[model samples]
Target: MAAALELFGARDPDDISIDDVAAAAGASRALVYHYFSGKRELYVAALRSAAAGLERRPPPAGGAGSLDALAGALARYFDFAEEHAAGFTALLRGGGAGRCGEVGKIVEGVRGELFASLTRRLPVREPGALLRVTLGSWIAIVESAALDWLEHRDVERRALERLLVDQMVATLTAAARHDPEASHVLHNLKNDR
Candidate 1:
């Protein structure tokens, strides 16, 4: 499973084969077949394995108390992407519209977790239609930025995390302008931070 996870993370699913996974794991192709139904099953399992421990590794709030929750989330996420660069990239880029149903669901499940986490931390009273859209948009923006950061490696991770957190704060601040409840939420966030 570890070998399969690394290979799937590091290469396109099409580029990898049962033979490759077996080779990586120092097992025979027949043995691999005994464990997994087939390639697709193994590939999806690899993705699931890679994502297993990531959902709970929230970043530390140390020195980021000003933007505590947002900062913590971004820092942990940045670290996860950096640590599993290949898998993270594959999950975001490969699992898309044209992908297999299971693959797409796995990808969207991770994304949905992200959206849910951020929305939960937010201090909104009644999350409206626009607010939901806005929160989802923020998730998209942060994910793209993290992918870019992983590929480029030019910007420092801390800088990237800071940029994303600030961008989100600005977005919420702007939203607060037109929404009284959002305004209250923003005020609470500011005071709490």
Candidate 2:
């Protein structure tokens, strides 16, 4: 799996083959087959392993249910991308068709976790609708920013990450302030001031 990840980082996922991985791992092709049904499965496994590693890392401390938490999550995501560029690309591309079913599940699990986290921080009148829009928009922005960073390697990754995090925090904070449930919370803060 590590060999596969290294190869994936060096080339496109479709260009990688079981033979390549097996040779790199010094394992028999049959052994690779025994573990993975096909190349797609192996690729998904590599990506899943990487994603699980990222998931296990704790979110930043302080402001557990606030925009700070969201920023921390985004920072973690960017850090993962920066460190494991190939693994991140494989994980993102594995969502396409003709891939392992488990890949979809992994993507769904991450999306669900992110949505749940954002939803918990949100004070929405219609939680479901608000969550859908907020999470979708947030993901779109982050994905776009990451892709942009990938295309321009010379760009400052940390600055780009901070810019995205700032945008997300500002957008979510504004939305929450207007939300009926959050309005009271905002009102209390203003009163306390």
lDDT for each of the candidates?
0.75, 0.68
Superposition TM-score, candidate 2 onto the true structure:
0.76
| Model 2 spans with C-alpha error above 4 angstroms | 95-101, 122-128, 173-193
Best by lDDT: 1
Please give, for residues 98-177, the per-residue lDDT of candidate 2 as tens digits. Answer: 64678778767766766665565544434544435655787778877876676578778767777876776555566665
lDDT of model number 2: 0.68
Q: Report clash pairs, candidate 2.
A: none
Q: 1-193, model 1: which lDDT tens digit per residue? A: 8787678766767777799999999999999999899888887777776566568685466333246877887878887887777777767776322357877777788888877666666665447866776677778989899888887889988888888877777777888777666666567667777
Every model's TM-score:
0.87, 0.76
**Clash number by candidate, in order:** 0, 0
The local lDDT score (0 to 100) that residue 93 gets in candidate 2 is 60
